[model samples]
Every structure is written in structure tokens, then in C-alpha cells.
Target chain A: MSRPPYEPPAQSLTGQIVDALLVLAMVVVTLYLPLLLKLSGAGVTKAVQAAPTWESLGQNAVMAAQWEKLGFDPAKAAEIIGSRFDYSFSWGALALTALVIVGYFVVMLRWSDREYRDVIAERFGDDRPPRRR
Target chain B: MTDITPQNLAGVAAPAAEPVARRVALKRVLGPAHVWGLGVGIVLVGEFMGWNFAVGKGGAIAALTACWLAGILYTCVAMIDSEITSTVAAAGGQYAQAKHIIGPLAAFNVGLYLVMAYTMLEVSNAIVTGDLIEAFTHNMGLVGEVDKRAFMVLTIVFLAWLNYRGVLATLTLNLVITAIAFAAIVTLFLYVRPWAPGETLKHGDLLTGLPYGGLGILAAMHFGLWFYLGIEGTTQAAEEVRSPARALPLGTLTGVMTLLIAATITWYVGTGLMPWEYLGQAVTPLYDAARLTGSAPLEVFLFFGTLFATIASANGCINDASRAWFAMGRDRYMPVWFGAVHPRYHTPFRSIVFFVPIAILFAVSTPLDQTITLSILSGLLGYTLMALSVVIFRRKWPLGTIDRGYVHPLHPLPAILLLALCAVTYVAVFLGYGSQLLAMMAFFIVASLWFALHRYKYVRRGDQFTMRWPKPNGY
Candidate 1:
């Protein structure tokens, strides 16, 4: 029946988080795609295996054999990725994330504003407050 | 007797019988997206780090199949958690939710179960990380062998330092780890000409006279349960999340689904590429697979990815587990001082300070397999209780909770079924390691004692709460 003595307010961040996710998405796409697919056809997987140190290692001796057949060359892949359409996707993704984050905060701002009606009514106005869920 | 009361005489209808007399504002932290990432990042990484080879290369077929099945059950658990959490949304994860619906003793036991379960997880992650570091170093011909205990201590110390910065810091670190883990998994899927499930199974299960025998499937599933341990972290953080009415469900579902798919594919492909015989024999299967599949650099990347994942697991656990103390301390269920948060960082400083050091000690002093076995067993105990809570709380309807999210369509059936699976795994654990009986029994005794002591404290505090609540006798 008794309310606890006090409850602390939840922590809020000054900087929005959704934007960070968007940036990560852009970064991963840029960095990951090239690493994954090699143009001369040796992908990042192959490149890692072919280096002399890896080729000479145990079991890697055989792994290197498979890497070559996969048609991966890291150098060529890098060139292709560098030449690819300048990060239109990154720009758009960030824009979209910004829009969504801003919209979410705006909605929450309005909801909290409704709660303040109680404070407003208790002190001055005749506004009836909304019932709590 | 009319539908009007003194307050409602002015044409205002009497308020419908309020289910709960107490109304509290649930805390708001991050949105569902970040919360989901934190929960998923916590469990997904360490399991991803360790199990990749077990499922991906060696027992790809069996391991992936186990993960898929486990993933389904995991989703069911998450859905059930979502339903319960939408209503409870308290700080204590499974412990509080179950306690309110069941009773203090039950909640206390749930907390105890989780403490052990998560502790096991910490040890397992440390051990796996130690193994990886050892393998990397040995292969590089740097050291003949790495001591597990030394590394465990290192891991604990490192994680403690990270967590000391507080929850926000851990959450940020978790995000980074989650992203890297996903990227690494996606890269594997994209680059590797992944093998078909059936083929991979046939190829990976190279261990003759294995795959389907007396409890091998059950044995592996028991361990594989690690991948799904912290799904409830989202639910526990329900009150803290922004708009938990929505975030709670979204975080639970998204986090589970994301981890499930990646885990499944990684398991399947890793298994298919490597001969199961070779995989079973190797020290750390996934790392071996990475080296075998690509080059030294990819192998190196796999190492880094796993390291990040383990760090994140420890980091996230430190963040979430510490909150238990904050809740307990704040409410006087435990010592009051533990409720103290760091002034500058706004974190559960003491709990964070406490968690990693003990975990690190276990990792360093205990044997790897022993630590792992304990971790999975303890986690299963918590999970089993949560699944059971779904059934119990739903049956007890008058506790004043409203669920505003999607309930699992099958309702009670999924939770019940999951409990059955949990039972099977529970028995399997006993079979896998009979020595674990001593550990399990010891933990049970300790829990019972703690439960009695906590109830004693509750009564002594004149807390205004009575025993036998939600039941026939009201103390």
C-alpha cells in the first residue's frame, strides 16, 4: 500500500543512438563488402590464406590451395570497391536514421507533455488530466 | 449500490476496479534497438567465439541442428519473457518477475539460479578466450602453453575496468562488439561457398559411431544453450528502456531472432567445410576452421572477433548483473549500501566492481571444462524457471499487469514444451558429468539458506509486506 520512499529517474543520453547504428551500417558496408568479395576473385578469405606465413603453416598449406581456386585477389577487390558509386547509400542511410530518431523523440516529447497536465491542473488551470495506464 | 460513488456523483462514472493500487513510472533508458543489441551482444559473442567451430566446421550438421532447435525454444522463451516483462518490467530480471507472481522464496531462488548460471557463463567465456589466446600464441610459436587461470584473471580485471566506467560505457562497448560479430558472421556467409545442411552434416559428423546415440544430441544441446543465455537481459531492462510498452517486446524478439539466424548459419557452414573428425580433435574448432577456410589474416580476424565477443559478454554481464544488487539494495532486500550508484558515472559501481573479479578468479583457478559445465548448468536453471514463470503468472491473473504486446500465438503450449526440453537437458547434464551432482546439490543448499535469511530480513525490516501473499494464507 505504501509507495517506496523514492524512485530514481531513468538515465537519458544527450546524443541519440540510432544515428550511431546508421553510421556503423555505412562503415560496415563499405569496409565489409570489399573484404568479402575479391575481384581477381580472391576474396579477403583467400588473401589471408595466401600470404607466405599462412601458406607455410600446418593445414594452411592445403587451405592455400583452396583459396586460389576461389578467385580472390585483395588488391583488385580494393580497387573495385574504391571505384564503386560514392557512398550514396551511406548518406541516405544516415539521413533516414536521423529522420526516424528525430520522429521518435518528438513523439515521446509529446507524450511526456501530456503527463504534465496534472501539474498544470494542480496549480492553476481547470484541465482534466488523462488517466494513467 | 448504484454505479456512482461520492467522487463520481458529478456525472463521472466510478473508476473501474483498479487492478493495482500502486502506480509507478517505469524508468526510461535507451530505445528498444539499443536494448536488444545489448542483450543479444551479451550472449551472442562469447558463444559465437567458442561454438563457431563446434557447429560451423566439426559438427556443423549436428551443431547447427541443435542451434536451430535451441533457437526455436529460445524464441519461445523470449516471447514468453516479452509477455511477462510487458507487465512486470521491474529491475530484477527473472528473479523479480517470478517472485512477484510466485513469492519471495521463488524469486530469491530464481536470483540464486541466475547468479550461478551467469557465473558459469563468465568462466566459460574466460576459458574459451584463454584457449584462443593460447592457440594463437602457441601456433605463432611464442609460448609453449598459456595458463588458463592467469588469463582468466586478466579477463576479469579487464572487464571490471570496462564496467567501472558504468552501464553506458558497457552498452557502447556491447554495440561495437555486436556489430563486429555480425560483420564477421556475414563475411563468412558471403565469402565462403557454404555447404548444404545435409551435406555438411554428413561431412562434419566424421566422428564415427557418433551423431545419434545415447544422449549425444542432448549433451551438445546442453552446452549449446549458452548461445541463448541472456535473452532475458532485455526483459530485465524492460523498466529502464524507453517506452518499454513497445521496446520490451521489440527488444526481446529482435535480439533473439538476430542471434538465432547468425548462430544457425555459422554452425552449419563451419561444420560443412571441415571434416567432423578433424574438428572434434582440434583444440578450438572455429579458429581452426577460419585458418583452414581462408588465410592467416582471416584466422587472425576470427581471433580478434572472438576476443571482442568474449569481452562484450563479460562487459554486458557486468552491466546487467550489477543491477541486481542495485535493486536488492535499494529495496532493503539485501544490504542498502549496494544500491549506491557512482555519482559521476551513474552506474552500479559496487556490483560492477564485484562481478568480474570473482569470475576472473574462477577462470584462472578452475579447469576449463569444469568451469564450462558449471556455467551451462546454472544458466539452464535460470532459464527453466523463467519458462515456468510464464505458465505460473498467466494462471495467477489478479496481480495487476497488462500485456500490450504480441503474446506467443500458441500461448501456454510453447512454454510448456520448452520446459520439457529443459528437463531433458537437465537430465542430460547429470549424465554428461556425474561430478556435477555435488556442485548442483551444494548450490541448492546455499540457495535454500539464502532464501530463509532473506525472508527473515524482509520480516525484520517491518517492510509492510507480508508472507503468503498471492496465496491462501495472508501473513
Candidate 2:
């Protein structure tokens, strides 16, 4: 019902560094959690592997069926599709690496800042802080 | 509202000034949900189309990685944008905020970029919508299929009509269509189950090789950018929203979270059901996902769903683009006619009208991928300026009782991070389209030249606003 007093908290350099580190840790966990699970023989890797492959990457069952129905070997058509689907995943790890770093910055800002938490409560919650009797 | 400008406050009797000041305005009818609808809706087309192209350039693994990175970048930017827009809720969105924090030149460039981004996106959606409709009808065995150009022209006109009607109509239409599009995605997840049925999924090892390698992911950045491209359009509704201080932040955060989830499902499950390469080439991607199930009616449902999604996105673009035009016109940054509102409709009728023909031209002439690239290019420019504005605001405005709605946490850190991501995106753009960057530079040069030529008119007439500390209470 009432707005909070406007006082931008002054975060010291050390406090800022601590917050940054905390955020970095969260980012590392989230960004790498899937890969870690895969490395640990979790089903996520299998599921990811099950995603449509480059060999058959561009051919749907219908397209393959259509090709087969047209008297062309479905395998040949799929191979052709695979060859054309050209984007390689060799540097995909780098993308994940980038994700980890960016994710760290985002999660850090969202979680580590005290003012942001209060602001969230004010915007989304009851818009009022508890009152003293 | 016009009284906020220095020209009126100084009682300038300039002959060029019209009595339409303050008289031409939009009514505040939007609430928090409307904001969410507009935010999510303007980007709904990205869910249905455009993103899959990245898969062709980068394999599934590379594309997925690029997509998530973009998602994180946008999430960070949106969080900061939420705070800034809430602090200064203006219809002009980033342009208005930039004017107060930076200066008129920054505001002018930012405004041009915002309008360019929204309108070009509108054109891209129109182009894609026309393609999807043609593909769907031809597949449906319809006797007479509509030509893509004619279809685009009609779609543009129809959307302009909806925008010309009013904000409430536009938002309501967007809400209904967005809900349907979201439901379609959920239904796709339920029915197709891309993650499951493992053996049926082929080419599983393709995730291991990045064909173009590390830099390929950067080339695919625009594709990832597609998922959440226009989410910032929500801020453009600040002047039309009821209690924007509470609603803008709530709406943007909610919308961004929802969009992130939607993007994840779209990238993972949609590609999982169909090969990413196929999705890359398909005109109607969601329709193809339905067709993969080998169900005729489901495909039809998704065809309509994709249509609805495109309409919602294109409609939102018209609404937001018109407002940006209106704001710029109000500031005398462009011709005053663009700022004029239809007294009857209380809408920026001229602004809405002007974009339709240009959008149709692009929709007819430009390739979908190129249109998308240009749209994202404008968006990156706008985002870069906005992120810079946040950094400037932090250094200038001492947080106090100055109607401060929300101050972003960690102060300059988020802004710095956003700027870094933006810099990386620019690098990716330059690397991908080395020659195209020159064209953008030329466009910017032309815009600056025009601004320089006209800067004195507003200054001489006291029509321009000067930058001040603390942004003078409210934007």
C-alpha cells in the first residue's frame, strides 16, 4: 500500500566482488549441469543424442517416406540431406562455455543483489512491507 | 503530456507549432496482463518460424548453444530494461529514457533503431506469414492459392487497420492469439514428444561435430536472437498502461520468463521432433512438427496456429512501431504529421498508415532470412544504446525520492554485462555480414546528417529538450 523510502544502497567494492563470485558459482552450476549429468552417464546425454542427427538431420519421416515412394533410396536421400545440413558441432563446446559465462552474469544479478530482491517483492508481491505495531 | 516539453512551457508562439499538442494522445487502457500479452505476442512469430535457420548454419548442438546464449543475453537486458522502464515509464520506451539520460542525438538514433527494428520485424513477419499461407493452402489442395506478394499486402493492410482501431483492441487481439500460440507449443510437446521415442530419432551423433566450428556459433547468433527479439516492445506501452510503475516491471519479467521457457521448448523439443535442418528449411515449422506426427488435422491445427502466432506478432509490431513513430514525431525529431492522432480514433493514424506500404515493399521484395537479419541488426543497435543509457543513468541519478520506481540491482554490473554481450553480437554481425555492416553505417550516417540539418529547427523553436540531472522527476 505504501512505497518504500528511496535509498539506493551503496555497495562497496569488496561486497560487489563477493556478489560477483556468488553469481559466477551459480552460473557454473547451471551452465554445466547438463554436461556434467551427461558425463556422469545420466540419461540426458542419451536424450540429447536421440535428437535428430546430421545424417538424417533435415529429412523428416514424411520426407523420407516421400523420397522412398518416389523410387529413391531413403538412405541416399537422407545422406544427401545430411551433407547439405553442413553446420558442424566441433566448436559447440565454446557456445556452452559462453553460456556459462553469460549465465553467471545474469544469475548473479538476479540472485546476489539485496535491492533487487526487495524490488521484486514490491513489484510482484503484496506491494507492502510488514508493519510494526 | 505535451506540456512536459520545453516548447509549450516557454509559451513559444512559433508559427510551425500546431494546437494539437496534448490534444492528440492515446488513452490508458492496458494493464499488467496486456503488457505480458504485448511483450510475448510481438515475439510469437519467432517461436513458429525464423529460428530454425540457425540450425542449418550450425548443427543442433551449435544452434542450441547459440540459442541459449541469446536467451541469457536477452534475459539480462530485459531485467535491466524492466528496472529502467519502471523508473521512467514512457511511451517512447528506450528513446525517451535515452533523451533524459544521454542527450537528443542519442535519443534520435535510438528512436530510429527502435522503429526500424519493430517495423522491419513487422515486414519479416508479413513475408513469412505470406509464405506459410501459400504453403499451407497449396498443400490443402486449394484450387486458387494466393500469391505471396498479394497476401503480404493484404496482411499488412489488415494489421494496420487493427492498429488504427485502438490500443485496447490491439492488446485484446494479441492476448487471445498469444494464448493460442502458447497452447499450440504445449500441445506439440504433449503429442509429438521430441525428447522421447529415442530410437525413432536419428543422426544422434551429429551433435558432436560443429562443422563451421566456434565461429559458426556466432554466425548463428541472429537465429538464437530470434527467440526473444521483440520482447522490449512492452516498454513502448508505458504511456498506455495503467500504473506503469508496477505493471511494466511485472509484465516484462513475467513475459521474459515465459518467453525463455517457450524458447527452450521451441529449440529442444521442436527440433527433437524434426531434424533441425528440416526445420530450418520448412516454411511453417510448427505445421511441419504436426505433420511429423502424420496427422492431417493436427497439421491443419498448427497451420492455423502458426498463422495466429504471426498475426499476433505482426500486430504487436504495428502497435509498438506506431508509438515509436508517434513519440519521435511529438519531439519534432521527424515530420510533425507522424505525431498527429486521428481525433476520432485517438490513434497515431498517420504513423500506422505510413509503415504499411513500406512493410509490404520489404515483404514482397526481401528474403525472409535477410529481413530477419536486418531486424535483428536494428534491435542490436537499440539494445546497445539502451544498455549504455542504463550505465549513464547509474552514474548520473543518485537514487532518492525522485519517483524512482525500480533501481536495477548491482548498479553498473548488469549494464556492463549487457554491453559486453551486445559488443559480441556486433562482432558476430560484422563477421557474418562484413559488407552489410557498411550499409548500416551508411544508413546511420544518413540519419545523423538529417538530424544535424533539422536540429536547429527544434532548438530555435524551443521544441527540443535539454538533458538534466535526475531526469526532472518523470520522463
Candidate 3:
């Protein structure tokens, strides 16, 4: 059998404009919300501050002195040097994580299975074998 | 079922006597060893440097736990990837699988993930190469300050040139250098002589309880990814392999096993020689361990090992990342201009050259850890999608509907386990790099929107499902 011709779905200019605007809004919210609420943690800040000295050059004194040589603020280097990992565990975080995982698995399976069956039916007639146990 | 040939599977006509620009395909010359090299070459660099960061996060014991946990996660990844890629037998690896198994939007995102992950990794490797050279020159008391940027650019240029010339030569070079790097690790393990009395390793003095506790072990899982980050990259060469059925799975499984052994030895030697505090933060833990041995010859061998591992990683990154971009281009997900293969070389010349400056730019400008985090996050997203895609693949194309190169044991279980592990790793990343995580999500979301509104029109969507197969189940 010969291949079938395909036509792309219609996309309106207004719809495209709306999508662009929505994407912009999402990017803004996802990036700025944490900083706006001060929910951002020591992770990235500590990484930037600590990496040049602590990661590249060993020894706290040498790292601090390198910062001094570069004419950066001494307090910033000191804070970075003293940084430590937060070992506390939150049960709420764990619960939410579990919720997201289960929710995603269920949603993906349902949607993808539905969409896949539709694709097969469209491409290759509606004949299907019986389900196996 | 009808027998499948590359021409029939790809649904393309054979090339004419003279090379035709539009019809050229990637050369199929690779074997199991090249596949193994591509997988392991991309990841062995992790053993040299970034894995040590796990020690910093949770101490030695926590790091070891993270290693085992991440190993299980990647084993699931390898099995799932081998099965899917062996059947798909196309460039773009997981991207191609997503296109055929799921849909276009997923394919686009998976392709982007592959490109971003490998490109960022290439940048990191280049920067490490330059830094290693500068440090070497300084230690040798060279006459002048060595500029690392020049070496970084040169590394990218040389590798890109090699890739542009041919696939066989590029991966053959990778196989050689990757083996040497692996041998270096074994040599170090033998030199330390852990089995002999009064061995060099001082594990009794050095082993410590998890300094950060159990939560720290969870946190360390993110860095633990460094142990085998790019092994899934083996499948990127699926289309080029001589026999995708036998070679892909063999190469991928063996690659993971190699990493597991290498990771264990690296941890043992490192923690045995250095204090947990120092081992955790040391830039080159293995090299430093060699320094502790006070063997100049051993130190120099490891220095070359670190250097070669970094180079091999960058080389493989260029290969995988370009294949992804080229595959996307072939489908017009990106511009068709990048789809062109060099008529004689049979390489994706445009895609290979396209990423050269981008890698160099990021290498010079971006902070090392930031790039590393973004690469890992991109990889995690790809794995999550892979887990979901495999389930969809099995349900739609159940066992008897079509031929499969390999079938993963206990279907659905690996998928579910992969999903769970990916979720835990996502949480692990969020606990530490929450801002970067959010930022990466935003970037991909925007890119998806762009593809939907702007790029989708150019893609001949129906042509993407070219692979000949029996009707999917439940049709």
C-alpha cells in the first residue's frame, strides 16, 4: 500500500500569540516566584561563591586569600567557607514527592495509552488482538 | 512477519551511483566495542572528579549508598533503553523512540534534553581539560602563565574535525582512549594493593559514619549520578551500529557493569587514602590519592588518565549531541539545513560544527557546577520520559505484534521502578539545587511552546512514523 498524505493541524495567529504570552508568563512565574518569596535557598548562591575558592583551590585559608586577591568582599568568602549542608528531612516533602510520582505515573499511563490506541487505529484500521493476561 | 532491512525499516530508497545530498544516510560501520566505548567514554570521567562531590554531601558511607542506589537506577535505564533502542534502530536514541512510540511534542523535548545534556557535559569536559593543563604547567614551573581558553577551543576544534571526517575513526579513537583511562583505574587499584598486608588504603582510619545522616544519603543521590551519567548515550549510535540487535544491548549492559566496578574501586581507594572531609571536596580525588602514595610515576599516570577521560567524554558528547540534533533536523523539527550528511564522510557535519562554538562559549563563561547541575537535570528529565515511554511502547506494541531486538524482563516493573527512582532523584536535586531546577523547567517549557506554535508547521509529521511494523495492539 502507498503512504497516505498528511496535513498539519490548523494554527491560528491569535492562538500562537496567546501561546507565546502564556509561555512568557510561565517562565516569569516559575523563575521569579521563589526569589520574590525568599524561598530560594543557599544552594545556587553557595555554589557560585564556594566553587571558585573551595572547589578549584583547596584549603580554606588559600580560598579566602584568593578572594582577597581578587578584591571581593571578605564577608562573602567567609560565609561560603562556613556553608554546610542542611541534613533535616521533612515528612511533608516526602509525602508531596510520593504524591507527584504516583499522580504522574497514573496520568501518563492513561493519556499515553489512549493517544497510542488512537494513533494505531488511525494508521492501521481498527482490528486488534484480544488482551492477554 | 516480513524480514526487515535498513532500507525497508527506514522507508528510504537506496542512494544512486553518484552521492545525492538529500538522500545520504549516516554510515553503518560501528560494532559492539564502539558502542561500549561511546557509553563508557562519556561516563568514566565521572569517576575521576564529580563523584567525589557525593562524599562532600553525605560523607564516605553516604556516598557509597548513593552509588549503589544510582547504579540500580541506571541499570533500569540500561535495560529499558536497550530494549527500546534495539527495536527503534535510529539516530537520536531516546528521541527517536519517543517520536515513534509517543508523539511529536515528546520527541522534541527528548531531543532537546539529549542536546542540552551532552552539550553542557562537553563544555564541562573542555573546561576541565584546560584547567588540568594549566595546573600541570604551573607545577612544572613553566616560563609563562598558560591560557586555558586556547586549549579549550583547540580541544573542541580537534574533536569536531575528527567527527566531521568519519564515525569509525572518531569512535575508534574513543575506544582506545577510554580503555587506557579504564586501565589507569585498575593500575591505581593494584598499586594500592588493598588485599596485601599493610595496604596503602587506610579505610579503618578514614571510614566514618554519615556526617549528614540519612537525609544526606538522599541528597548525595544527585551527585551519585556522576558515576554513570552518560552511559545511555550508547543508544545514540543505534543507527550506525552494524547490528543494532546484538551490539546495542551488549555494549550498553557491559558499559554499566564496567562503571559499577570502576566506581567501587574509586570509592575504596579514595576513602582509604584521604580523610572523608578532604576526599569529599578534593577537585581530583583519585589524583590526590596517588599524591598521597608519594609515587611520582603513579601520579603522572593518573594525571594522563584524568586528562584522557575528560577528552574522551567531550568527544562522545559531540557525537551524541550532534546525532540528536541531526535526527531532529532530518524530521524538520529543527531546520532541514542541519540534516545534511557529508556525502563522503557520512557524518552530520553541520550539526557537529554547529555546537563547537556553543560548547566553547559555555566552557569559558559558565561556572563549572552550574553547568554540571543543568546537565544532570536535563538527563533526569529524559530518564523520566523514558520510563513513561517504555510503558506506552509495550502496551501499544505488545510482545507478538512486531520483532524486538531485546525484551526487558518483567515488563512494567522496570518502568515503575525507574519512575520511582527518578522521582526520588528529582527530590534530591530539588533539596540542593531548587533554583536551577525551576530555571531548567522554565527553559524547556518555553522551548516547548515555541515548537508547538512555530516549529511544528515545518515538520512532515506523518513521515516520522516510517518504520515498518505490524499494527500496534489495541488498534
Measured with C-alpha atoms, the lDDT of residue B149 in candidate 3 is 87
Q: Residue-wise lDDT of candidate 3 within B1-475, one digit each (tens)?
A: 1222445343323231111123446777899999999999999999988788788777899899989999999999999999998888888999889887987777888898899899888988888888878876765568998999898889889999998998898899999999999988999999999896246776765576877778788888888998999999999998888899899999999999999999999988888776565566556667677767778799888889988999999999999999998999777777677777887888999889878866776677655656677788789989999998898788877786667889899888888998888988888877666656667765776677677667777665345665676655554
What TM-score do all the candidates reach, one by one? 0.68, 0.75, 0.82
Ranking by lDDT: 3, 2, 1
Q: How well is candidate 2 docked (DockQ)?
A: 0.02
Q: Write the per-residue lDDT of candidate 3 for residues A43-73, one digit (tens) a residue.
A: 5323344344444433344333334433344
lDDT of 2 by residue, A1-133 (tens): 4234233234455643453344234323422232234321101011122334423345445445434432346444444354442222334543543454344334323332322233223322323335621
| Docking verdict class for candidate 1 | incorrect
Give the 10-residue window scoring lowest on summed lDDT in candidate 2 chain A. A39-48
Instruction: For all candidates in order, state the fraction of native interface contacts they contain.
Output: 0.00, 0.01, 0.17
Real contacts retained, model 1 = 0.00
Model 1, position A27: C-alpha lDDT score: 23
Cα distance off (Å), candidate 1, residue B325: 3.1
* lDDT (10s digit) by residue, model 1, range A35-54: 23421111111123233342
Count of clashes in candidate 1: 20
> Under CAPRI classification, how is model 2 graded?
incorrect
